[model samples]
Target: MNILPSYRYQMADHKKSILIFYVVIVGLSLIFGFSTTLIINGNDAAVHGSTSGNEMATVIFLFVVGLCTFKETFLISLQNGVSRKTLFTAKLLTMLSVAVIMAMIDKIFFLLYAAALSITNSQVTASTFYEALYPSSTAGAGPLMLHAESFFFEVLLALAAMAAGYFITIMFYRLSKTGKVIVGAGVPVLFLMAIPWADQYFLNGKITIALVKLILTAVNTPSHMAVTCLLAIVVFNALAFTLMRKAVVKQ
Candidate 1:
């Protein structure tokens, strides 16, 4: 089946929200930069090179978009006689397209942030999550390399986040009301209460330490993290497809 219609639909669904999210975020960043500059000029503080991890907000935003994308789009696609395969393809395309667009915008925003920092003589530093993740690699890299690396990594990271969100919403959709309640409550309880408590008391922090060590070792560099993100995206999307294949449309 032709995937254009479904792809276009998915893109259209996210366009408005993405626009508003960026607009609000950029506006806030500008206000923050200028305000901080004003404060510095008025005071005798000598702080320099303050790091802002604000770019991480994009990942959270994409995760929210993923959570919101599946249900309505799935129902609409089914109503339009779109097969699950076609719909899934369209979603993949939509994710890639949106991720690239977002990554480019983020790069441009970083440039703007740098300019703002220079013009206003702000001490607050602007950097990408990629640089934060792989500082050693970024430290000696040229501007061109840093930008290219960040754009690619952010695209992968963004895609992975969305895939995770999509998988979660689809999993919820596949569950019954009682199952939903169990998962919604149980997962948090397991993560926030049970696991943490057990790890602290019974396991003596072994679990948390081991998990952290493993994550840190495995994702030591941007390239390594990119692979991890790719794996996450693939696994999550594959699982989502399995659920969507048998998903029954409901009101």
Candidate 2:
């Protein structure tokens, strides 16, 4: 059984969902873009027009896509006579392709918004999710290179999220009811205990400072962070595949 055809088929199955997501993103972008343009045009003061919101929408899209794709596809593919290994490979390929395509669509929307602003003679400041997340000071690179870097970084993040979501779904599927209850109760309790303990003892009661430092580190060295994220994605996917190898399809 060829995996490419299976991957393509799976992707095609989700085309409608992808299209709806694209439409929602474009609609939101247009609303923000035009509203900012109109507001700035009406103002007497030299207020800078700013269009923000796409980043949040992009994140939501990636996260929801990641969360929904795995369990459904796993069961369906398994029932269709596909081997676990092939299904795993196909799912990985599908996630990568979707991530790349969505990233490109995100960049296109940014360009389109800029062009729309130009046409309306509006001096709006537009920034992508990547730019907002990882602002840099030194800039000798061309726009193309910067966009490419952003695209690559976003793709890695999307893949990592997808892998984590898939792993969670598989774990949920394989767990007993009592096991689920323990996990559901134990995780939040662990977090509640750990956060305060870390803040009080380890962080000198300055959780905010620790968080700020972490964000600054990530923003300052995005390339290194991207590599770290990719490594995490590989590890997550490996574990998910291992779990799935023993997963029995539910009737």
Candidate 3:
């Protein structure tokens, strides 16, 4: 069987869901943008509006979509007798394609927002999500380079999220009912209880400081952050595939 064609067909099945997601996002953006414009127009002094929330929304949407896609695709493909290897390849391709498309859409939306602000003669300033993510260095780069870097980072982040979602799904699928219960309930409870205990007892209330230092280190080293993210993506997907290879389809 030609796996490429089969994969394309399987991805096509998700067009409706993708379209709905896009529509919802666009609709909300319009509502918020217009409302903010109106509010600013009514004010006496010049006000600036920011669309920084768009990046967070995009990340969350991609993550949720990734989780749904992996779970649904795995079940359908398993029922249809698809090999684990083919399924993994298909999922990887689908996630990359989706990441590219979403990144382009985000850029387009930013342009549209900027144009609207200009046309309305609003004092509001708009920036691309990439600018928000890499505020300092992005401002120094040429437009093409800035966009290229943004696209690359978006693809890496999306792939990482997809891999994580797939790995989680596989873990659940491979667990027994009791194990699932333990994972679903016990894990969260442990995190809730253990975090404070560890911070107070083990770290002497310095966990927050350590976390801030780690974040600052990462922010200072973009290349290292990118490499770390890529490594995480590979590890997550590798674990997911390993689990899938040994997983039995649920009856």
Winner by lDDT:
1
Estimate the Cα RMSD of every predicted model relative to the unseen true structure. 1.6, 2.6, 2.1
Ordered from best to worst lDDT, the candidate numbers read 1, 2, 3
How far in Å is the alpha carbon of 165 misplaced in model 2?
A: 1.2
TM-score of the candidate numbered 2? 0.87
Kindly report which residue stretches of model 2 are placed more than 4 angstroms away from their true locations once superposed: 52-56, 197-219
How well is each residue in 1-251 modelled by candidate 1, as lDDT tens digits?
Answer: 69999999899999899999989987898788777777766677676655454457888899999998999999988888899999999999999999999888888888877877878766677777777767888999998988888888888889999999999999999999999999999999999999999999899999999999989966897767888998999999999999999999877
Tell me the tens digit of each residue's lDDT in model 3 across 201-249. 8888798678778887765555766886788789998998899898886
* Model 1 CA deviation exceeding 4 Å by range: 49-54
Give the alpha carbon lDDT tens digit for every residue of 1-251 in model 2.
78986798779867998899888777776777777778888899988866642645655666677667766777778778888899888888898888888778777877877776778778787766676666663255578877787778778887887788778778878888899898978888876887878788987879867777876776467776787677879998998998999998764
- TM-score leaderboard ranking: 1, 3, 2
Which ten-residue region of model 2 has the weakest summed lDDT?
A: 132-141
Model 1 lDDT, residue 185, Cα: 97
lDDT of model 3 at position 189: 84
Candidate 3: pairs in clash: none
Model 3 TM-score relative to the real fold: 0.90
Strongest candidate by TM-score: 1
Question: What TM-score, over all chains together, does every model reach?
Answer: 0.94, 0.87, 0.90
